[model samples]
Target: MIIGVVLLLVFFLVNISIGSVYIPIPQLIHGLLGADLDKASWETILFLYRIPKAITAVLVGISLSVSGLQMQTFFRNPLAGPYVLGISSGAGLGVAIMIMGGSALGITFSSSSNYMTWGIWGIIISGSLGAILVLLLMSLTAWKIKDSMTLLIIGLMFGSASGAVVSVLSYFGNAEDLKLFTIWSMGSLGGISGTQLEILSIICFIGIIPVIALLKSYNAMLMGERYATSMGVNIKSLRWAMILSTGLLAGSATAFCGPIAFIGIAVPHLARMIFRTGDHRILFPASALIGSCFLLISDAISQIPGSAETLPINVITSLFGAPLVIWLILKRNLSSEF
Candidate 1:
């Protein structure tokens, strides 16, 4: 626990300090303490850009890691993740509809008007709702059918169908809306603000509460659903809770941070390697911390200078995450035994 906290603080500080302007340590400390300095451009850069980006990275990390862990256990698959199962895609479809489709419908939302962007919230909710719908269908199939792989295929098919719908919506959308969607699809840590950050924190906390509360149950579930059921785990209720939790974490992260990738699929493996244990009590927190650290590092790398400009976060993440994923697959460590 102590190491986790220390690593988190160090990574967060690194994220806040290594941006383009490179504010000195003293000014960064002063700005954080609410001190009244000359308000230099570097200080502004630290406060306005890096701080929010750091916060977004940490929150997104925790959200994705927890969601991934839950999905892995729920589906009884080692390779399960938010994106692998199409939860992120589902959420993306939701946001694409709201931002791109809303403009197509002639809805005008501004930064100042809270009511106008309820449609954005609607998109997020619908995305989560769409995931829940798939989960329900999977639950039904699980009872009548026996193949977990079949359920996974259904999830992928549902996600692909949703993506197709989004493509159709984009076809009819105006050029400006298409551009907005494209930028959003590229993903970033710059989109969240203090107020939105608070809301995101609350949503994630609520989402993971059940996981924390059911840590012991999760341990049992990790052993296998049959064992968990034998140990008095309420399989039905637990499935529902996990689906909702996965939705909240993945949906909220996608809503705010624009569909980050790789952390979910990779962080749990890091946690397992660190602790050498499959126990949820340790795995949960360790995965969250490692996920945050990994994303903070990725976000820092995205701020590389001497280029034409900072790369899109998605591009930087793919560079790191995709190779790791490929390696994991080639090594065959993604099997259920792990």
Candidate 2:
């Protein structure tokens, strides 16, 4: 745990310091302390852009990783995740509606108008509602069905349905609106403003409470539903709590940073490999720290280090995570650790 935390901090500082224009440690400290620097641009870049982006990377990492851990524990399926379960697709649908649907109806949503202040809230609320809606449906299905594999199939169906709807909306949308949604879907950590970062932080914090509270329940559920029920775990209530927590975490990340892929699925397994345990008490914090570090590293790489041009965050993460997913599938041993 201590090692994970230390790495997370180190990478976070590296993320903040090693942008296009590298700021040395002494100058970085001076700028952070509000001391006048040789270049005013250094202070502006450090304070206004890099800091918030780094913070966003941290929150995104922690939220997605922890949420993935919860899903893997609750569903007891190696392939299950926010994207697989349709939560991200649902959030993407909400964003599509807000951007494409609103534009179709002659409504303007941008940072230039008076509605600018409320725009982020609108996206976040719509995304959360969309994710919760899918989660509730999945919960209902889980209640009626006793098979985890069945629930996994149902979740994939939901993702497909939502994706179709989004595609239709995109077809009817204007070129400019399509471009905006396209950029958002690519997933950029650098796009979050200071105000949006505050909102994302608060939502992620609230989302994590339910995760922390259910650590014991998660450990119980790991042994299978029958065993968990034998141990007096309220399986139904636990399902609701997890779905709600995941909705807030995954949905808010999608709303602010677009639908990030693979981290939610890959990070828990990475944590397990690092920690060498199945205990939720240990896995939770380990996943959070490792997830943050991984995303920070991805963010740093995406910046192209020393270049003004940058790659999309999703591209970097997918490059790292996609092969792991393939390996897991080929190995067919997702349940080995559990």
Candidate 3:
């Protein structure tokens, strides 16, 4: 835990420091501490942009990582994640409908009301609804299906269906709207700001709190349902909690930052691998910290430190995460803690 915290702070500072216009670490600290900066623009850039982006990256990491850990435990499948299981895709579809297909539905923002005001909430609400809907569908199948792999495939199918809908919507969408949706789908950490950041932070904590409160129950869950039932754990309520947490965490992040991939699935495994434990008590915090670091690293890389160009945050995550997934597949004895 101590190491994770230290790493998180280090990565966060690094993330903030390594942007398009570089700032020395000492000056960065001085600026943060209310000292005059060498350059006035550096202060503006640090306070207004980089800090918020770093904070957003951290929230995205914690939300997705913690949510990913919950999904892995709930399904008992190594591969289960928000993106792989269709939760993100569902949220993406909802956002797509709101952003791209809104005109078709006769929804329009008046000149007096800019998009940021009403649009942000619309995206969050729609994304939440979509995530909830898919989780409910998965829950129905979860009880009946004993095979983990089969359940994962079902989740993929759900994601595919949602993706198909998004594609159809995209095809008929106005060029400007389609471009907006496309960029959103690619994912972003720098997009969130002021009010949106607050909402995301709140939603993530709401999702995380339940898991923290139920750590013991999650540990029991890993021993098998029959074992958990014998121990008087309420299986029904546990599932619902997981659903609620995952929905809020995954949905809100997707809604605000776009559909980020891999962090959800990859971070939990990284936590397990590094910590060498299956205990939710340890894994939960560990995943959150490692996930934050991973995201900060991704965000820094996306900035293309030496260049003005920045890649979509999603591209970096997938590029790094895909190989980890492939490695996990090849090494069948994953999660030694399990």
Which residue pairs does candidate 2 place in steric collision? none
Candidate 2 per-residue lDDT, tens place, 10-64, comes to 8978889887898887777777777997888988898889999999999999889
Off by over 4 Å in 2: 107-125, 135-151, 324-335
Task: Pick the winner on TM-score between candidates 1 and 3.
Answer: 3
Each model's lDDT: 0.75, 0.83, 0.83
lDDT of 3: 0.83
In every candidate, how many clashes are there?
0, 0, 0
**Residue-level lDDT for 8 in candidate 2:** 83
Worst 10 residues of 1 by lDDT: 108-117
lDDT of 1: 0.75
Instruction: Indicate which candidate wins on TM-score.
Output: 2
By lDDT: ranked, best first: 2, 3, 1
Report the C-alpha lDDT of model 3 over 297-337, residue by residue, as the tens digit.
99999999988899999999999778876686567566454
**Candidate 1: segments with Cα more than 4 A from true spot:** 37-39, 106-151, 306-308, 325-337
Which of candidates 1 and 3 reaches a greater lDDT? 3
Tell me the deviation in Å of residue 280 in model 2: 0.9
Arranged by TM-score with the best first, the candidates are 2, 3, 1
